[model samples]
Target: MRTAEQVTFGGSGLNRAAQIRGDAAALAQAMADPAARCLPMWRGKPLLRGDGLDALGLIPMDHPVLAAGLGKAIRAPVFLGLEEDGAPRFAHDLSRWEPEELDYGALGSFVDRSEQRHPDLPEDMAFAELRRVMTALSPRDAELAATAKAIIGWHATHRFCARCGVETVIGHAGWQRDCPDCGGHHFPRTDPVVIMLITHGDAVLMGRSPGWPEGMYSLLAGFVEPGETLEAAVRREVMEEAGVPVGAVSYLASQPWPFPASLMFGCAGEALAREITIDPVEIEDAIWVSRADMMTAFAGEHPTIKPARRGAIAHFLLQNWLADTLN
Candidate 1:
């Protein structure tokens, strides 16, 4: 897709300086430097400030919870030193504060006071407010949100040792966790999901999951199983859901959908058979819509079907495909 990276959370080329993950002194300096700033994550959502949504808010290392986590006795919390416009940026989770806004749906309701571990408090932040503020931010702010969400989510979940059932310690600048008892090293987990656009000539296939809103139809997607190739996964998923035989699958674009950490691999697949055979177990219904119909759907003119999500890769790919720019 020509404008794939133009999608929200697609690509902004932030320098994820992984090389400095092991440099304790350097990481400390970066965290403490006045120029150093950390993007705060409430639950899995990133904080956004300013109009254009272009202003990225950076939480300082001295914030109460973060200070505790990175104390000398407590070992420095894993932090990523990212670079934007030749300047350094940081990411951290304020899962320690109770966010004031709660109506932003699943992304905004992250208050977990039971953890008492101040780092687990949901910050007084709201996802919808952030979105509103970010609507006018510079491109860098949007990109910074993407990076912060991904890293903070990683920190929130990988707090235990997978091998010994013991509490693990953060290490390697927040990229790794070590279990002292088992000498085990753990890293963030990212699951691979295939979100494909299956097409037969001018029409494309789309469906809605059982739990989705009334008319919300998105490209069929499924997790890529162990040992399965992206091409094979596309074929299998399409066949299982719509009973369509797909051939000549190709990569389109990708997005980091960090609801809990997932890499959405957007793809395009050619349909070899068009006979409609909906798998009641996999999808509520399957439909083939012509280019014109899709354009209507995108424009909110279609009465029965809503458009694919705006910020998602599916919407991005479909828009480009309609414009004949999927090259």
Candidate 2:
């Protein structure tokens, strides 16, 4: 399990400057430093370079691309963390100024599928989806992108205070929202989810959601309910989704899945029974694949089922399981 951090979006050791977030003067000092860098995002796509999906583009604070994207608007920057050299880094959401006439390609119903354009940036500076290329990114880059996306997405959805229904303003270096009326302070939230790798002797249980591409399967996952432990969540999810009883659940690894801010807790579960009674609502299909069949799937030689995403925790765990490297 020590290889846990090696999973995509897991092991970035960014020194999150938590102590200075509330210090306005310290924040200003960091921002004014020459080494200060800012990452830009349009819609939800982050600006990245290079030919592969793993590339992330973090420009200097004085970059012209940002000025062209947002004009002179002084939006609050999210202070992600500091680099190993102590240079401060921040992220700005430049999704406010997208041209109305560009094609964004195909998209999901709830996604911001439109890619933005800027007069100052080259064509290769386009923002792209994080899920498609998270594995290709350096760990720090992935963490920064995930942090920015999650905080920005939170600000977008939670503009008002739940306590008194008052509009809240960003504060605490974009980590908190303050309600002027009720003295309420709100911080960003990271929801907990448990994704299970269930084993039954030689086979592993995998499930397919209703809308996933045909033959695509992955570890069964579900959000943790109030007051549920990680072990309990794994057991509950496996039983609820696949009607398979589980025992002795153990943690393996974790990942920051910022498809709008989630911490995926990867766990191994010993299934008490192999028979699966699929929950029609939770998943469309449930099947157990023998270790040999999974090897074929991973090698792209399987006739039907495709492998889990290469960098995702599911695939990481599966690969290790096959290699007997789950320590």
Candidate 3:
């Protein structure tokens, strides 16, 4: 999809600079060089500035929050570039910052840190705040924020050695954590998830999980079980959720949905059958909708169904599918 990369974190061709991960001295030098910068992640939201919020927030390496986190840092920072403009950008952490309350329509301004301050911040801010801020960001910024949150969250949760049950220390610029006692190395974990748009002619199958907002639905998705291929996962997820067999599954796109670290594999599949036998344990309901209905949903004109989430691969794929540009 032409707009696939347009998602906030989708196609920013940021230079990840993976080769520098192993060179501690070089990494430290870069951070200290004054040219280096960081982006802020509040909860899991990337900080944005400016009118349309396209102005990505820039955080210097020496910022107080980054210093506190990176001073005892674990992973090397990853940078993303604007695919359209090729400009380098940072993802910062603003979890330590304060927030201002506003109406849903006015929420967009929260991504701009210039609207608030961090004075006497609490030590334990809820992750929900981050979600709120993230919801306010553009798709691409949300993706970047989600990436930072997932990575940082991994560091926080995996501080213990899985091999020997011992405390681990951060290493390799936060990519790996080493167990002090057992000599074990633990890396950030990204669980694989298969999200597919199952099309049978002009209609696509969508489902809603239990507790989702009324009328809200998305493509059926689930984790790739152990020993399963992506194609296999796609078929399994569709069958398990909607009770519909899928064939000719093909890869489409991907997104880093870092709500605790998940890589969503977007796919397209041919429906082998039309009947949906919903699995109450897996999904609340499953239904098929024609291309015209989907277009209406995307436009927020469908009274009973909302569009797939923005910034998510599901929404991205559906948007492209509607435009006939799944190339």
Clash count list over all predictions: 23, 2, 20
Candidate 1 per-residue lDDT, tens place, 44-100, comes to: 455544332345556566766555333221244445556654356766655545534
- Candidate 2 deviant stretches above 4 angstroms: 64-74, 103-105, 109-115
**TM-score of candidate 2 to 2 decimals:** 0.94
Decide which is better by lDDT, 1 or 2: 2
TM-score of 1: 0.84
**Residue 233 local lDDT, model 1:** 99
Residue 179's lDDT within candidate 2 is 91
> TM-score, each model?
0.84, 0.94, 0.80
**lDDT score, candidate 2, position 98:** 56
What tens-digit string does per-residue lDDT give for candidate 2 at 163-212?
Answer: 99998888889888899999999888899999998999989999988767
- Please give the distance, in angstroms, between residue 285's alpha carbon in candidate 3 and its true position after superposition: 0.9
Q: What is the RMSD of candidate 2?
A: 2.3
Candidate 1: which stretches are off by over 4 Å? Answer: 51-54, 63-78, 84-86, 99-139
- Please give, for residues 47-134, the per-residue lDDT of candidate 3 as tens digits: 4555444434655666666544341234345443333343334554444444565244434442323333333322222223343354
